[model samples]
Target: MQPQLQQQQQQHVLLQQLQQQQHVLLQQLQQQQQQYVLLQQLQQQQQQHVLLQQLQQQQHVLLQQLQQQQHVLLQQLQQQQHVLLQQLQQQQHVLLQQLQQQQHVLLQQHV
Candidate 1:
């Protein structure tokens, strides 16, 4: 081959190799960027999951407190009902005693 033609062919091959290397480097950079985005998304999801668990725990605690308050209120109502029942019984006893005394006086007068 002529010397100038040989040098031109070698230069062409070198240029093609450099272009291929540039393309490969571009592809590698794109893949790395995609991986970084995925890692960021995964971290966000984990943070959201942790926040959801904390909210659920708080809800459970509030529910337990509400149930305890309801139980205490129920106990107070029952005690009030028991007191009212006792008062009614005492009033009935007093009325019965009064009726018996009035009957005894009427019977003596009739005799």
Candidate 2:
């Protein structure tokens, strides 16, 4: 009866040790899960940051292209205005010559 009691005591101690070990393992597993969740969040934030940078670069390129196009359009408009001014000056000169020639012919007929 004494050996039986000692055996029971040993079994109880082993059971307690096992329960403690299980509790420690559970705590470690919870910590690992939390770490994994944090890692995932960090990775997601990095990806979002990279995407934002790419978008901003694309926008910058588009703005530069638009500005170049505007500059080219302005140059073309300026050229067209110069050409129109030359045409207007030529027309005015021709009209003045015609008026002078008509007046000279009328004066000769009166004489």
How many residue pairs clash in model 1?
Answer: 0
Over 48-99, each residue of candidate 2 has an lDDT whose tens digit, in order, gives 9999999999999999999999999999999999999999999999999999
Candidate 1, residue 29: Cα displacement in angstroms equals 1.5
C-alpha lDDT values of all predictions: 0.98, 0.99
**lDDT, model 2, position 51:** 100
Worst 10 residues of 2 by lDDT: 98-107
Q: Estimate each model's TM-score.
A: 0.80, 0.82
Model 1 misplaced regions, further than 4 Å: 105-111
Best lDDT goes to which candidate? 2
Q: RMSD in angstroms, candidate 1?
A: 2.3
lDDT (Cα, tens digit) per residue for candidate 1, span 13-87? 999999999999999999999999999999999999999999999999999999999999999999999999999
Off by over 4 Å in 2: 100-111
